[model samples]
Target: MKKLLITGLLALCLLTQNLLSQTAWAEDANDSVPLKTVTLSEWEAVLKSHQGEIVVVDFWATWCISCLERFPHMVTMSERYQSKKVRFISMLLEDPEEPEAIALAHQFLNKQFLNKQLKGKNGLAFDHYSMNENLMKSFEVLDLLGIPAVFIYNKGQLTHRLTGDNPNKQFTDKDIEEAILALLKSS
Candidate 1:
């Protein structure tokens, strides 16, 4: 019984240490990178520049648990469709009024881009973006209650909108992939 207690206590300590290290790593990652801010018009210009191709716009935030939950699948989808004529973009929908929030959003992007689970295994990532009020209004963001929302654009036209955690409804990988495949076939 004493041996068993010792082993369990050791395990608990190791687990606690691991969790602490992970938290520190996250904080470090957030502080190590700098992110830029862009206006709505500039964001639109980016979409316009990518016209004539399939663009997946993912609207997410650093504080959103649901967005974090759904992020890996999106990353996988990005990797899967990378060879096709599809472009994946992650748009952070942070507080447009808070500069600190915007900075945190960029740090979150840095963490994601450097994440071993998302990038190390596949070596795949997408361009990161942050959206302002004008951009959100242009994208009709008010229509939705929560994110992470995904918009599929084809040739500069909004084609599909996928939302996460709407009354317990979340999009699956198959759902997103089907949309991309349909768009590719259409183009």
Candidate 2:
């Protein structure tokens, strides 16, 4: 009985050590994933830099339930349209004053990337940006009342703006995919 008790305790200690190492590795991996905070002007500059290419800008927040639900579809879309040169950009809308919100966004993104949601057939396929201004002000500047908004651009021109402003006009992943296909066909 004494030998058995000692073996059990040793096994428990080894298990705890392994778990701690895995947690540390996950934290380090999350920290390495770059999440850039950009102002509206800086975001515009990013769009301009990608001029002449099809761009899909997804605006979401870590706290938004609908946004989280639709994020996986966005990842799939990014992979689908990657070969067509469609740039997928995820803009995380969070209060810059709230460090915890920023941290949560990082955690959310880390999980997505680590789970292979953000990876394409080739590799990583999305650009991530966090809003660097007040949440309400950022929404106002973007002319949006609420999020889970996706803006599709073609040749640097605003093409389709998908939002959930009205109950009757809410969009789905299929709608976004159709819009992207239309833009690609037109180009």
Candidate 3:
């Protein structure tokens, strides 16, 4: 009977240790990265704040496979244009009301090393924002109807709107790069 109790106690201890370790691992994964929630008005204010600078805003979501696939290219563009006056911003379109969605977004960002890459290490500062679902739906000013959209703004003016709405006329990363190059040359 004493041996049975000891064996049970050992098993309990092992289970407790395993649970604690898993919790710690989860916390460590997300500890350094945080998703900032923003309303539509706040998003407008962010754009207004960066008036004179060229802003490249990539609208993406965790569920969009194309967005995820194209994200690395945006990061590469951000790194390549680090010496310029362009600002790369990633706007995550997720339901802020859902905690799980927000957590998943953070996990994705961390996995992509987005937090580290966009930390303003060298030249241009990068911004990451998670838009509320209602705000995202109401954002008609951009006339955005799809994911994998990139809006390029120069001197507070919308210069380019790249979207994959049309099946045949989809935009590519090279197109985005060319737009930025043209803008840079003009400035």
State which candidate has the highest lDDT.
2
* lDDT digits (tens) for residues 73-138 of candidate 1: 776787777788588888777768787877767666656556443332233336667766753574
User: Cα lDDT of model 3 overall?
Assistant: 0.82
Off by over 4 Å in 3: 1-31, 114-117, 120-124, 139-141
lDDT leaderboard ranking: 2, 3, 1
Better of 1 and 3 by lDDT: 3
lDDT of each: 0.73, 0.86, 0.82
Number of colliding residue pairs in each model: 0, 0, 0
Using all chains and alpha carbons, the TM-scores for the candidates as numbered come to 0.66, 0.80, 0.78
* Candidate whose TM-score is highest: 2
Can you list the residue pairs that collide in candidate 3? none
Question: Where is the poorest 10-residue window by lDDT in model 2?
Answer: 115-124
What lDDT does model 1 reach?
A: 0.73
Ranking by TM-score: 2, 3, 1
